[model samples]
Target: MSADFAGETARLYARFRRDLPSDQAAELAAQLGLTADDLLLDLGCGTGQLTAPLLPHCAGAVAVDPEPGMLTGLRDRGLPGVVAVLGADTDLPQLGRVLPPLGALVVGNALHWTDEASALAAGAALLRPGGGLAVVTQGPPLWLGGAPWQQAVRAVLEQFLGPVTATCGSDAAALADRVGLLEAQGLTVRVSSWRADHPVDAAWVLGHLGSALPGDALTSGGLRQALEDELDRQTGPLVEQVLTTAVVARRT
Candidate 1:
């Protein structure tokens, strides 16, 4: 299934989607043996959240996404040493022709949207000798976890978005499965986790929900009002614990 974001949805995503912390990005870079001479490829780079921060550590980067609006957001940032490419995981081979052999290919929270095996193979093909591929998957959204206000938020989400999956990407089994797939593609895989806390207010919560749900769902279904009312009942700021797991695989 092709996942493409456009229009206001892309705008919300660019505004609300969080980037990986700098410390975590540096740690992953070190693990991948990325250096200033290396070229990084950020596959499915939504608004350059995970791609922009890592630019300083690499020679240059190619940020690829199928959505033009997301690319426009990235381009608007005017980040140097980065080129935005309009393509998906399947187009990496063609992308390689225009760009140098990559030192690392990074996929953040986007592996589920593509053919995982084919994407990995294409990534491996694009990498230079001794280059690597890294896949970073974040844990569940804060609203889905066991916080008092978060519980209320989730109830509103379920009422409109249907039953939420407990474990979408960040789980032990899923990590292991990704490792196995990478290994099968002739890569030596390693996994690591990072934990951080993010403080968010009511506005952040609502914006996050808006990014996930369609505008019609939020505006027409009375879901937006219900969420606002529930959030208003909360007393303090919400602390969201972010757990990011990285599966790094090196082509031998």
Candidate 2:
């Protein structure tokens, strides 16, 4: 857990990050054969983005994240049947001692942060027989390689952050690696996608970047104004089609 997603940064993340789709949750529930007795374990929950929507589909949810600040305010967000825990992928075995039998285990946009193979193995151990495991990629950031408007955003970001690429283990090669891991455990891999479109303005870009960069000088030292100036000139549809990919499989 980095300070980038802690304290004030966590608040920005909670406010700016989009909620995970209910349709996707439903899909996982069906694939996992979720019953009223099964609980969903949401690793890297990050303010319950996956947990809240998933809770209704399962008996209850165990939302875990390593960042303590990131775990704050999840309970007050009108979520019932949600238990937030400050833990990480590496702690799954110990965490499992206190958790119920899981019908599904979801790692949403957080696989790149740890030893992915180990995390996947630990997650598998916690599942009940015939349960499902899903790894979701939250897609690239808004300023990731794209149209000219985004190129301009990228340029400004590069000036401050020094050569950034949106490689978050969502690419084809990373997916293949994940699929192989699941197959090693005798779980057949199935990949699915859910998409949400976000139109970027200066404010939206600022919030999104702020969430990721928090406390960085990128939004300071006059770079914020420069980014705004650069964006003001680019004219085209700047909608970011966030294609959320789910690499899923069931225990066979």
Candidate 3:
């Protein structure tokens, strides 16, 4: 999340990536018993995607990221009472020392990049009793869903971008391990999931892909034009089915 979302790449991420649905956030807030007296810690909070939506449920937020650009974008958001920190999951214990007790901890499409056990334990330690940690997989990787449009996009990506196999840690196996980590901390586990479809054209698809691409690869060669043209040709009126999941674990 840090290296990938730096400088203009960070802006690309902010533009293409979306916040979680507000209704879902509200339900989660209610389930977690979040109140205005509470504070949230958004771990690996790239561009504050999780923070922005969930912040309204709480009094304030502490958004932490390892990338400076990410902090910059988050700060630009001007979220009231937000304290943007330049740090990673490993820095959580140190953070725990200074911040107030946490009401909820959220990792949105990000735990895959961290040392799962350590980060979760650190986050758990920061939470007050009855508070929770919600880990969200904002849907699968852009190039790796099972829909026709998804497969078509993968084909286009493979033709130009090599094999498109990264799951951003949302694969079934990764998710199972995440659940185990949550349970290992002795928290009660429950999940909320749904499927929805969105309409998109080739440029939308291309920009989403660009957001995930590292550094100048999007600007590198003939990749951009080639992808858009080929994608438009082989693809139909595009509809992508997003399978979203939220693993909410609450401390007793």
Candidate 4:
């Protein structure tokens, strides 16, 4: 739910797209019963990373990113049947124009950036009855364990950038909040948490952090290399983190 971590985040994700786990996407799609008839909306869609992969699975999908650069990146990728819209999370005017009543609306890690009440209200209004909403997010496990490398990266990243914590993460509380929010709007909530063992060390942490860093932070490869080298020196590959969570709800 970070509004500030757009540019560098997009750049880093653009790089990560090469390593995307399509298996994970397929799993989530199966869990949600995503269909070609289902209209999916990717809210806070960063560079259409999720949006593009979703095209082959869903009937049609629309990706909305407020950042133009991110939208351009998504467009350059040329995802067929997926339309990219440039708009805000709370107000998706272009979505209204491009999509019919959505069968599924996805807010990937970006819902945390919106006003909770407002977003919930909008979801209630936008989705068709029986439609589903999925909130997906990822973060390092160090945040939970207070591990040295995790602590180290957070200290520096927070120092350099603002606290771009994954607020609506794979936590029980955050997932519960999504369920509660949906139920409050008279929707059926189905919540599930799945964790993936990602190889982590200082190098991996730096790559992940680099994804969250500001745009200017990545302009110089030397600076990126220096940071990565620092991370490598501090921590070895022993830090394997569990990448988790996909909270899905349905509008009844």
Model 1, 12-127: lDDT tens digits are 88888888899999999988888899999999898987898788789999999988998998898899989899999989888878778889999988888888889988898888
| Runs with alpha carbons beyond 4 Å of true place in candidate 2 | 1-3
User: Which pairs clash (backbone N, Cα, C closer than 3 Å) in model 3?
Assistant: none
The window of 10 residues in a row where model 4 has the poorest summed lDDT is 138-147
lDDT of each: 0.84, 0.81, 0.82, 0.65
Q: How would you encode candidate 4's per-residue C-alpha lDDT over 1-252 as one tens digit per residue?
A: 334645567766665533225776776676566777888888888877567666677888878777877787788787777778777765764456546778777777677777765676676566777677777766433443455666665655555455646544556777778778877888766766555556565545555556654555644546565456557667355454556467777766
Off by over 4 Å in 4: 5-9, 17-20, 140-148, 155-172, 200-207, 215-226, 238-240
lDDT of 3 by residue, 36-95 (tens): 899999998888888998889999999999989888888988989899999999999999
Q: How many residue pairs clash in each candidate?
A: 0, 0, 0, 2
C-alpha RMSD of candidate 3: 1.8
Candidate 4 lands at a TM-score of 0.79
Residue 231 CA displacement from its true place in model 3, Å: 3.2
TM-score of each: 0.94, 0.93, 0.94, 0.79
Q: After superposition, how far is residue 140 of candidate 4 from its true place, in Å?
A: 4.7
RMSD of each: 1.9, 1.9, 1.8, 3.8
Better of 1 and 4 by TM-score: 1
User: Considering summed lDDT, which 10 consecutive residues are worst modelled in model 1?
Assistant: 1-10
lDDT of 2 by residue, 1-252 (tens): 133578777887787777787887787677667777788999988887778777777888888998888788576586878888888998899988987668999988888887999999999888888888999887766677466787788898788777778577778899999999988878878988877777767787777777777476655688788888887887776777788888988887
Candidate 2 residue pairs that clash: none
* Stronger candidate by TM-score (3 vs 4): 3
